[model samples]
Each structure stands twice: as structure tokens, then as C-alpha cells.
Target: MQILSRPYGALHYRLDGPEGTPVVLMANSLGTDLRLWDAVLPLLPRGLRYLRYDKQGHGLSDLGQADRIADHAADAEALIEAVATGPVVMVGLSIGGLIAQHLAAGRPDLVRALVLSNTAARLGTPDSWQARIDAVEQRGMASIADAVMERWFAAPFRATPALALWRNMLARTPAAGYVAACRALAEADHRQATAALRLPAMVIAGDADGASPADLVRATADLIPGATFHLIPGAGHLPCVETPAAHAALMTPFLERHAR
Candidate 1:
């Protein structure tokens, strides 16, 4: 339970692994916190430090607002500086992936490699995201939990006990935080920026992903030079939760090859 205070607000984060090793900074999906990486973290390559943080308004982080994805990227820049950690392998999911792309282009010095999981360069149009925000605003997080869960996990995973935990997490998220993220996704268009990044990158997708389908993931990967792409057979949007081992299988090698 570490908190780093920023001009906007405080961000809750956790650091793990050896102090002197290369770092891996993880950004969570919308409506989730740093814990989203729990299942996949342990299976990563040894000797690399990991930093996970909850974006403002999510988890233990302070409540705040962000209209542009760049604002979130700037917050991440401040976070890395506050931690005094060295260059990192940036790992992000969903909205986190958009932030990763923003960081890789804007603060290249802080990112040695990048992993984009279950994300797109551009999500839905502004109107679509606005509708989602209206739904949450009027009815609370519960209003969209079923639809989000259906998109987040495969049917089989949703039938298990784990589904309850994820549902609770989503439902408990701050409306301000969740809606702010929705706005960020609505306004964010990283296609031009991401297309110019030359950094080493790995893009992972789940075949069952309804939010960011495999085709969308592949298209994002296509924008990068020399980026590798992988498809997890039975997983959905949140593959780290649905198929941690499979996500790790793809991540460990990338970390081993690049994070060192």
C-alpha cells in the first residue's frame, strides 16, 4: 500500500522483485486496479522489478479527472520520476495499453520495451463512450457490470467462482474514476503516435475478446515496426485473469530478451 502524491492527487502503487534489476511498470485496465496483474506477475522472468499502480479514482488511488489520454501519460511520467526507478518494460492492458502507447512515444527514455494486452489504439467513437458514461452515471457501476463482464471474460471463466471477485471489483470502483476513464477512451486516438514508435513491443490478444477483438489487436500491432503478436485461444479481454499462464508464457520471454 504505497502512495505517491501528485499535483492532481495521490496514486496507489506496489513495487516487487529485486531493487537493482530492470523494471516492469504495469498499468491496469479501466475499472480495475494494480491487482489485475497479480496472477501474471509471479510467472514473469526473475530478476526484474515490477511496479503496478491504480490510476486515479481506481482502487486506493486518490480521486481525480483526466480528459485526454496524455494526462494519464503525464501522471505515469511523474510516477516513474517519483519512484526514481530506471527505464522499464511498460506493460499495460485496455486503457492501460493506450497509456503505454502514449508513454512509449512521449517518454521514450522511461520505456525500454512495451507490452500491449487486450487494447486498441482507438476504442469506440466519442458517442459510444459517452453512452457508457451516461449508463454508469445514471445507474452506477452495477448498470454495466454484466455487459462489461461478458466482454471481459470467456463464458467458462464467468461461470466460476472467480467471476464474483471481478464483478465486485468493477462494481466497487469509483464512478468518477470509471467515467473519467471512459472519457479518456472516448477522446484518445493514439493511431498516429503509436505508428511512429520504434521500440520493441509485444501485442497479445485473446481469441474470445469481445471488447478489443483479435483483429483490432493485430491491427494495432501492424502499426509498430518489428512488433510481435500472440493470440490466447480461450481467453477474453482480461487474459491476464482468464489465462495467466498463457499471458506469462508470452511475457516472460519478452522480459528475458528485453528487460535485462
Candidate 2:
């Protein structure tokens, strides 16, 4: 783990593989830290550089004034610019996908390719997200950890030890930061921005994902004009956890093909 100071606060990140090799920066889903990529990390080709970081308020990253997805994207851009060089393959999931879209649209020079997984161009989150943010602000992160976890993973994942670990992480998250992230998701609108991105892109979705359905993923892929779409079976939102091998197989080629 390494700490890099940004304009808002310190950002926590892990860098792997060779420094001079092609860089891959991974942004994780909401409510999940960089640990969410643990299962898929080892599957990546070792010759390339990789960076995984906890968004503000998640994992070991600092809690900054983040109340919108743009703020998150700015922080991410700052981190990438501070650490990696030009033209990185940015891989993002869930809310991270929105951030990636924002980055690619706003700062195309830094992004060479994109992998958006289990996410949408625009998150049509119902009022439930706002309600949850209010609940967290009023009560605490613990107040909604269970409910959030239920929505994060599928039924089978909830029965595993990994679920317990995830729950613990949620419980430990600062309520203020969690609420901030919730508010960010509530205000984010990536539809227009993502539609305009012309980078080499891949959209990976889980057939069983309720959050970002397959049809939505297909629509997003269609909008990207020649973007590749891969749907993994027996997986929900977190395909890297539910079907790591399949997820890795699909991503390995895409990343390698686009690597500079």
C-alpha cells in the first residue's frame, strides 16, 4: 500500500508489475474498496503495470469533500496524473465506471482504453440511494451496511466468508464518507458523457446483474460505436468475485490488445 497526496487529501493505492510497462488503473465499485479486485489481480499479465486505489471514503483512502461523481473523477484524475504516465487503460466497475467515463470524456489524453464492467452509462438509481444516504447521515454506516451488502452480492455470495469480510468493511466505513459517496451517485449523470467517448472500449457485464442489466449494458456498448461487449454467466454485479476466471479471460485480451 502506498499513499499519495492529492489536492483534497491523501489517496491510498497499490501498484504492481513493472513500472515502465503499459499501465492499467483500476477503479472499484461503490461500497467496495480496491480489495474487490483481489481475485482478478493475479490473473492479469505481469509484464504490464497495474494500479488499484480506494476511492475517497472507501478502504484506506482519505475522506475528502466528495459529494458528486465529478469530484470523485477529479480525485481519480489527480491520482493517475500524480502516479502513472500518459495513456493508461482505465478499468472501472459500478460507480467507478461512471468515473472512468467522466475521465475519458473530460481528459482523453490520459486514457488510452477503457473497460467498464457491471455498470451503466447513466445510473438510474431509484430514490432508494438518496434515502440510504439520509439514513446513513442520520444513523450511521452500520445502519445500512446489511442492506447495502445484500444488494452488492448475490444470494450465494452472501453465504460465503467473503461476505462476512465485506460486511466488516462496510461496518468500518465512516458514515460521513459513505453518505458523501451516496450523494455522488445520486447526482451523477454519465449518459451524455460516455456516449461521446471514442476510445478503445470494452463493456463487461454479468448476465444476472440486477443493478446494471444486460440490456442496459448492450445499449451502452451500442452507443460506444464498435465497443466490445462480453457477458459472463452465473454472475451478478461482482463478476470478478463470482467468476474470476471468466472475467480474467475476457479482459486479458482486451487489455493486451490495447496496451501501448
> Quick one: best TM-score, which candidate?
1
In candidate 1, where is summed lDDT lowest over 10 consecutive residues? 78-87
Question: What number of clashing residue pairs does each candidate have, in the order they appear?
Answer: 0, 0
lDDT by residue for model 2 (38-143), tens: 9998997778888899999888888888888888888878877887877899999988898898899999999999999988887767486888877877888788
lDDT agreement with native, every candidate: 0.91, 0.84
Candidate 1 lDDT, 37-88, residue by residue in tens: 9998889888888889998789998876676788788878887887746788
lDDT of 1 at 148: 93
Residue 20 in model 2: lDDT: 77
Q: Which candidate should be chosen as best, given lDDT against the real structure?
A: 1
Query: Candidate 2's error at 213, in angstroms?
Result: 2.3
Every model's TM-score: 0.98, 0.94
- lDDT score, residue 132, model 1? 96
Error of 1 at 115 (Å): 0.5
